[model samples]
Target: MNTINVVIIDDEFIVSETLKSYIEEYTPNLNILSVINKPNDAKEIISKLKPDLIFLDIQMPILNGFELLKSFEEINFDIIFTTAYNNYAIEAFKVNAFDYLLKPINVNELQNTIHRYYLKKKNNPLFQYGQVKSLLEKINTPNKTERITVPEIGGLTILQTSEIICLKSDYGYTDIYCKNGSKITSSKALKHFCSLLKNHPDFYEIGKSGIINLNYISKYYNEGTIILENNIKVSVPRRSRKAFLETLQIQ
Candidate 1:
């Protein structure tokens, strides 16, 4: 068994880490190289790391898995796409026989995918890369893109506007807190995202560092703070209080 180096790219931290753990624990000669969640960083990492296999997530924000593949002139390593949705399964397999793992990855399916790769590569040691455009073309395009594209460290996170509870700034980055209790730390500043989401009327700026979801407000406090549905308290600074209160009243 050759020591195969592996890199994983997924917007979800838990999903990417879980896949890393599963590969390391179950695969005989697999070496988990790196786990990245940002799509922009993936290209640089992939070029520098030079992993034998890459576990990629398909529906990342801004730049998707397919877009990433299209950027490369020639692919040197194998790619296995991980997708949460099932709509792309048949088309994914159709494109160059590349494999895809549905979210909540099944243990047996994972083993089979790895085994298939080992068998194919063991015999040839040279796997040809496939064209991503054909499959991408046939896929459904959203009539209106309702998801917010947030650029994070290793990849991009595509989240529903409703799912986001608030945006909190820390140092240079913005923390996107979700209703599901997931937080995405983005490379961009809070103001940048605040501007991008300006079209969405529900986002409210609390003071200088906080942006709260008006739809998820639990209660407003006398201290100019508001509690969110998930018990997260967002403070409204004195400067923004009058406008904030007015906005709340109108809503």
Candidate 2:
């Protein structure tokens, strides 16, 4: 059996140590190169020692494991990510990660994950640049651009959900009002934007004509009316009013 060079990166020392011990006691032909707690510290380790595998914990202080991956130019190693139950992060992992082990790592599950690692090691085609790009886009999407890509006559316009104060219907098309004083007319109807933003936590409908991004909103008036940042006002009808307020409170 070929020795699999591995490094473990986790903020919790005990957690990393426990995993190290488990791998040593239960898994064979795996050489532990370095056990690191900090992402910055892991940089030197990674550059100096090109390990075959990395047992990465997604959430770490100063820098989470995912952030560390961005620093590396060439990711030629397989990764088994460890993360807590984060809705977005979990969704991102669905795109990548050989296998993700949830917190309070189960020895049996760990063993199973290691077994899968061996199977993948035979053809470890993980973490290509495009794959990595898509993966991070999924993870960082909600809090980042979180934009709706609208195809236009000239090219395209990306309306960042965070910057959108509200949306209004213009016949069949939708007019997106931004905090930056730019107005956009998307070919899609207001209902389409509503559906796209339905799962998105930042937007809520006001009246029949409009949807407003929650982060930009300051307060809500009755019947879908809302006072947004910079005192820009917008409103929706009574039908969506109740649902919008409830969604606001939940958000």
Candidate 3:
């Protein structure tokens, strides 16, 4: 059995310790790397150590686990949120977070989560990395040009791709803001829409989770963020900043 590296992010010291002990006692092959209390600290750990598994807590004073997860945009790790809240499970899974375990720690449930995590990691390479890549490929499929299919809450709404002001990632869905003052959520990953819309020359893949319709962009400021024609502000991730700027001339 290969050793699985793990990190625990919870404000509760005892809970972290408990899970650490449980992992050590039952899963001999699982190595407990480090337990952290701050969500921000997890970012540094993630960059440096790159732990395969993380036991994250949903509710925290500052950033919270989900925000921490969102901050990364591009995650190569598998997460198991050890939260007291159950209401956010649906939302969490939407962003591709693998599993959730409620607090007051059940050993059996923890074991089950670990088992499921391994299975998912082994089986779904698409969920881990390929899905995002596949979606990106679809976005870059088209160099530049025209209209996009705007999926609404009720149904599909076709809108000119050049009229799109900005794109935002909500959970797993993409919200498209158009020049007509209408906003619609795409029924797929932002990357999916990016792939399909990338056919339009005016579209720019701005952020890790956003694509901006450059024709509607008013100005670029504060490094990577831009103001759209509709007065909407769209952010460009540091990773995609260069490409976003370069794509501005695609038309």
Top model number, TM-score: 1
* Cα lDDT, all candidates: 0.77, 0.72, 0.67
Model 2, clash count? 3
Tens digit of per-residue lDDT, candidate 2, span 102-124 = 76677898889888777766664
lDDT order, best first, reads 1, 2, 3
| Cα lDDT, model 2, residue 149 | 55
Better of 1 and 3 by lDDT: 1
Please provide the root mean square deviation of candidate 2 (C-alpha atoms, Å): 16.1
Best by lDDT: 1
Task: Assess every candidate by TM-score.
Answer: 0.56, 0.54, 0.49
Off by over 4 Å in 1: 132-251
Candidate 3 lDDT (Cα, 0 to 1):
0.67
lDDT of 1 by residue, 1-251 (tens): 77989999986676787788788778868888889988889999999999988998865666667778778776888878886544445455555567778666777889998898888887777654544445555653322224555767766666777788999998999999899998899887887666555546778777779888899998988778789987887888878888988998999
Where in model 2 is the C-alpha error above 4 Å? 124-130, 141-251
Q: Residue 91's C-alpha lDDT in candidate 2? A: 65
TM-score of 1: 0.56
